[model samples]
Target: MNSGTKQHPWSRYVALGDSFTEGIGDPEPASLGGYRGWADRIAEVLSAGTDDFAYANLAVRGKVLRQIVDEQIEPVLSLRPNLITISAGGNDVIRPRSDPDEVAVRCEAAIERLKRDNATIVLFTGPDLGFSPVFRGVRGRIAIYNENLRAIAVRQECVVADLWALTEIQDPRMWAPDRLHLNALGHHAVARSVLSALNVANVLQAYDPEPMPDGTWRGARTDDLVWARTYLAPWLLRRARRQSSGDNLLPKRPTALSLNGPRA
Candidate 1:
């Protein structure tokens, strides 16, 4: 007589980031198919054979770096994820103050916390916004943030995905209309890129040919891709313009209202 039981190979993953990580505007109904975010795609690619692997996407739209560290990340760690993917700092760099040092500190803290649990961590640098017309002034800020991120990744011995350089040369159409988030094709590209980095870092096992597609996997079609790309890309561009203009129109604070204002 034998007992019946199944064992899962790679079951637990935790994803951390802001809007991009959350797959904002990818579409409604967060299922396996239809606008699957990169993290979900990665989880699927890696956990193809195992039922044990589970992914928890803790990303919140519009979340800045510090907010994620304080609100979302701590609770996720209690679950003891085996793998963690963090794609934060975009909101931090885009904010008016956009303090790179502060962002780095929070990211470092997240990494340390995850490492304490013996989790394999992957940190994603922001995509280069140099191509975006509205994000021109903050382009330099992105570079600074990447530098800090790279230093921290090195120190923590974690994997760093250089999405900044990869997406920079790609066509702007790869981005959604918002010009910030990625469309389906872009998400697929990101998934491949991140998977490759994980493989290179020896965090993930080499890919084996997947079995014949059961009715389970619902890959997005061209029409879905086009719609996502066409609609969201422009929307992102418009949003970026509004944000840039708002930054430009901001009035200088009165001395009394400023933190450094009115010397005692």
Candidate 2:
């Protein structure tokens, strides 16, 4: 499939945020940083017909809004990209006692600084987690944050990749085994949304994950117990210790360079 007639205006693009932008769950060992995330997917589509198109991703995992503003802004400014996508505040929003409004304020500050060069900025809303057995408890908080992000997009004159409205992601199949980050299917869904938000046409297709076999109630409970022990318990321990999964990790693709991937 080919891209649509709408020609995108950007030649240089940069991505900034946490694990969602970093491609945490979609492991591609051959790709830079060993992941082909939504940003990378977008870069591929945007670079399809243009040799001059260049991209950079400065997103590290486990970064809060303030950390993103502090750590990523300088590198992005240095890139001087014409297009930028940022998905911050998710980490903050999920933390205990964190205020969504405050997170939005920090996000606005970041956007204010980023748009100084008149770049087309794109912001992402956190997904609706109403279907997640683990994260459903925080659904209301995420909704508030999404509203804040929508308002920020309007005031900042930026585009919004409204993940909160993408109903396809509400399924557990769209999530990674850890249930925090997106799997490949979820990342692809996000890439498609980003392109739509930019009004860029692409050939990416909707994918349906293989259906899970039905399980007995006891089996499901046992699975949950195993998940808690393997993935959840360690995560809680890290939070207790004030540690992060991305501690000391560097950006996968820090420089803006032409992408090489399967064309649309």
Candidate 3:
């Protein structure tokens, strides 16, 4: 490699985390996982800049921080890519039974290893979960996790793609009907932010926000009943059974490949 050559934030990029990194709500027809997320979106933009640009997404839909570190740490360290982003821990701390301190400790350990690589590591805090009445109780835990994440980023010298301060993330329309994952627009907002943080060229050009909801609470109780019956009940059953959304699923894009190339 030429020492004087400029790098474009990433030539080899990798993403790691949970559902948010996996693109749960943003539908994709070609991939079996059925979604294309911020990582993919950023990869596409990078691909436009250089044919050498490649990307890998190892994020599954439901892994917690420790699991993510266990599954991803060695592979990512081996890959030694120039860029990486991790968006985990939400699945762990969102539950009433989980410990925020433990999750943070696991995450800090993971970030320390990621920092050992020459690659730039980008980190995103889980957005405010309080907007959903169902997760209101866990807001304190999420807040604590966010604070820990911010401190960890500083210590690791990793770029923090801060989500907690994003004003519009609290809007009802920014989320999916399930109220746990982000909808299309919410994903777009995140992608934009992630790219901007990377100083990717013309990131603002990717702007396509989901419109805020009108009369979102026109029939609050009726909607709550539907939400509970449709999404909450199944989630509880999964927890009781010790199951996960990513169970039987695989990363949609597991190996680094150019955006215009086939997945490896």
Top-lDDT structure, candidate number: 2
lDDT of each: 0.62, 0.86, 0.77
Q: Which tens-of-lDDT digit does each residue in 1-264 have in candidate 1?
A: 012212333457777776666665354354422345666666655554444556667766666666778766776787678777888778767767768778778778878877977788888887777666667788888888899999998999898888886752255545564555775556656776786777622122222212223232244345346655775565467556643212222111101110111100
| Alpha-carbon lDDT of model 1 | 0.62
Which tens-of-lDDT digit does each residue in 79-178 have in candidate 3?
7788999998888887767888889898888887887766899988877766677788888998899899988988888888888877566777777888
Worst 10 residues of 3 by lDDT: 1-10
Question: Which scores higher on lDDT, 2 or 3?
Answer: 2
Better of 1 and 2 by lDDT: 2
| lDDT per residue as tens, model 2, 1-264 | 244534678999999999999999989897799998888988988887776889999999998777899999999999999999999989888888888888888889899999989999999888888887777878888989889889988998999998988998887777777877888888888898889999988878887334345678898789788888988999999989989899999999999988764443
Q: Give all candidate RMSDs, comma-separated.
A: 14.1, 1.9, 4.2
Total clashes, candidate 3? 0
- The candidate 1 region of ten consecutive residues with least summed lDDT is 255-264
Predictions ranked by lDDT, top down?
2, 3, 1
Q: How does residue 70 of candidate 2 score in lDDT?
A: 90
Task: Report clashes for each candidate as comma-separated counts.
Answer: 17, 0, 0
Where does model 3 exceed 4 Å of error?
1-7, 203-221, 261-264
Arrange candidates by TM-score, highest first: which order? Answer: 2, 3, 1
